[model samples]
Target: MKYQYEFFLPQNPKPIDTITGDIYDCEKKADEIVAELGINEDDDLIIAVTEVGNND
Candidate 1:
């Protein structure tokens, strides 16, 4: 079972905006992205993890 991480920008009073459709292999890589993007603690950013290559 493989997994991937994704990041999104939160839309005010609505859906989250996709920052990158690219999937990260590890959580560290995803965290790096947040740092690289200079996302602040007060910033509306969302981090998610999903299963990859899984049909079931």
Candidate 2:
């Protein structure tokens, strides 16, 4: 058996526009990092989800 873990941005941060319910990217900036960079900006913010394998 093995366990998995992931590191993401925000780290439980607050939202930017409560009315719009905006979300921010944990890894990189929205304007800075674009689809060309292999990351898409969903809504007005960006987000990234990654996992690590348990090398035991």
Candidate 3:
């Protein structure tokens, strides 16, 4: 699986490409990053999504 995240600011015109997940995980990694950035749901929205890919 491939995992990544997008962070959006209400006042910004485009989304910010935040950190990418490691080979094994996504959600916990995102939580850690959001804490580091010090922003919560009211300040912005962080979305984590995953897509499955071929083993090759």
* Shift in Å, residue 54, candidate 1: 8.1
Model 2 — TM-score against the truth?
0.19
Give the per-residue lDDT of model 3 (tens digit) for 1-56: 44455656567766665555554455565466578777775456646455545445
Residues 22-47, model 2: lDDT tens digits: 23333333445444445345643524
**Residues 1-56, candidate 1, lDDT per residue (tens digit)?**
55555556676443232332234344455466567877763464666666556534
- In model 3, the Cα lDDT at residue 40 comes to 76
Name the runs in model 1 displaced over 4 angstroms. 12-25, 41-43, 53-56
For model 1, what is the error of residue 56's alpha carbon versus the real structure, in angstroms, after optimal superposition?
A: 16
Which candidate do you rate higher for TM-score, 2 or 3? 3
lDDT of 3 at 39: 73
Residue 15's C-alpha lDDT in candidate 1? 25
lDDT of each model, Cα atoms only?
0.53, 0.35, 0.58
Model 1 whole-model lDDT (C-alpha atoms): 0.53
Error of 1 at 44 (Å): 3.3
Clashes (backbone N, CA, C under 3 Å), per candidate, total: 0, 2, 0
